[model samples]
Target: MLKVQEIRELIKLIDESHIDEFSYETNGTKVSMKKNGGQIITETPTETKPATPQKPQPVQEEELKPQEEVVEKKDQETAAEQSSNYDQEITSPMVGTFYQSPSPDQGAYVQVGDQVKQDSVVCIVEAMKLFNEIEAEVSGEVVEILVKDGELVEYGQPMFRVKTV
Candidate 1:
């Protein structure tokens, strides 16, 4: 079994790295961690091939809070969709900090109601200290901006919503 500090370090490494799944096993104890969207889930499953796998223990109520947050976030997105179903989004391709403009001195790359084409540059996403320019893949008019400037965004997070002509 890993020490508490060692396990925390592993979690930090996972948060910083691009790898989505990782597991550590030693002396018949295994710890698995997985990332979904921007959330990390840690699971420890005991191996019991020699004996009927003891019915998995029930998760405590405290362990269920994170799942509740995921559900709430989904409901919030649903509410946003209901406000404007015609709005199609351009989501972030990677997890990073979103930048609306190229630099501090410049204004935003695209604003609401601005017309755009498939190849139009919309914003930038900074990941691992690298600035990546984001492009719109669908031609339309920008209907809404889902994220704030300089906000940390997760993979597939909606950055811009457009209304197709």
Candidate 2:
């Protein structure tokens, strides 16, 4: 497993390099990381391959068609569930340091399960030595907080999950 510091360094390198994709292989462990539309997707492929003997008989074309249809339906259901759980996600407007409070001595702007109105301040993001307050774009209950205080955040990354009112 990779340490937290290593992951942090990787994120810093990614930001500094402005690279959309990166892959690393070490000790037989391979990890592929990519950022698309602000979403970070990671994929890891196992090094082991299954050993099996294949039959020479050919599969029927009509029989295989139904299997394909079943797989397609399953994929559609999975996609729909992902979208329905979070009504609207508040994403990072710019790459910066995410701060949950006005200052280190203050309470957080908002916490999980808090009710917020449109334009309510939820957090602050500091970029290039300037601190910018982030506001909720819709009125709702915050279902989740995606980033920790003082953590570096990327542009377009999901920061809050709000269930619309």
Candidate 3:
């Protein structure tokens, strides 16, 4: 069986790499992890002997917590959608720190309400000391900046929302 720290390290390594799915099994223990929509899901199914069938019972109060969390997440998503009137977005291509300007003393590349061409460089994402300029893939007006300067961004995270022409 893998220790908690070992599992955490494994997850970090997998997230930093391009691999999507990983699995390991030994001595009847199984561990599996997969990336879905940029979220890592882990499963460790144990081997147990089959039990005699029994009558079903109502779910306990504790069992309802997960359902409540799901509902809360849905509500948050709906609120965000209502707040932003955008047709497109500029997403971070990798996990990194978001930068609004080329340098600390320089002005931001683009601000809210700025018009952008398809090839316009709107921001930069620095990963592993490499600064990568992120472009606007669609001609549009910048409707929102989703992340703040120097904030850590996840891969595929939307950095800017645009109203496309």
Candidate 4:
């Protein structure tokens, strides 16, 4: 379980960073916080559930190797291949799962050829089950969507490449 002081520090760090929200759970305690009105709002519920023991499942080497290769290869190619002087990248502000839309059934927030202004919400990055709205930091035409939906993205992972308008 995390102490109040530690939680406050974590919130401070998040506030200073680009992360929009954070969540953590351990030892029957859960905490969820979000940036609201330039202040941190933390919610702690009193209800707790008993911990359950589970057997660990072994990961298949074939499955794991391909995923690792794909991620590394893509990151390298994205860094070296497409960007030009006039292009700008919209990168993941935090390590989390990349989502193009708010929900599975909804249409994507931005697609290739879409025009976006600075501060336009282009996607979501969900960490620890807390979905954060990610905004485009530049005004431009979205030339490409760099990441597929539901992919685990690292901090600074490029999500979109935009051509300045």
Better of 2 and 4 by TM-score: 4
The residue ranges of model 4 lying beyond 4 angstroms of the native Cα positions read: 1-81
lDDT of 3 at 63: 81
| Shift of residue 109 alpha carbon in model 1, Å | 0.6
Per-candidate RMSD vs. true structure? 12.7, 12.6, 11.6, 13.1
Could you tell which candidate, 1 or 2, scores higher by TM-score?
A: 1
Query: Please, what is the whole-model Cα lDDT of each candidate in the order they appear?
Result: 0.78, 0.77, 0.78, 0.77
Tens digit of lDDT per residue, candidate 2, span 49-79? 2223422222344577799899999989975
Best by TM-score: 3
Per-residue CA lDDT of candidate 3, range 11-41, in tens?
Answer: 6788688888999887787767777734323
Q: List the residue pairs that clash in candidate 1.
A: none
Find the 10 residues in a row with the least total lDDT in model 3: 42-51
TM-score of 3: 0.60
Pick the winner on TM-score between candidates 1 and 3.
3
- The TM-score between candidate 4 and the true structure equals 0.53
lDDT of 1: 0.78
Root mean square deviation (Cα) for candidate 1? 12.7
In terms of lDDT, model 3 sits at 0.78
Q: Give the per-residue lDDT digits (tens) of candidate 1, residues 1-165.
A: 554336546767886899789988998878788877343232322322323444333344448779989999999998776557445788886778999999999999999889999889899899789787888878999988889998999866888888888
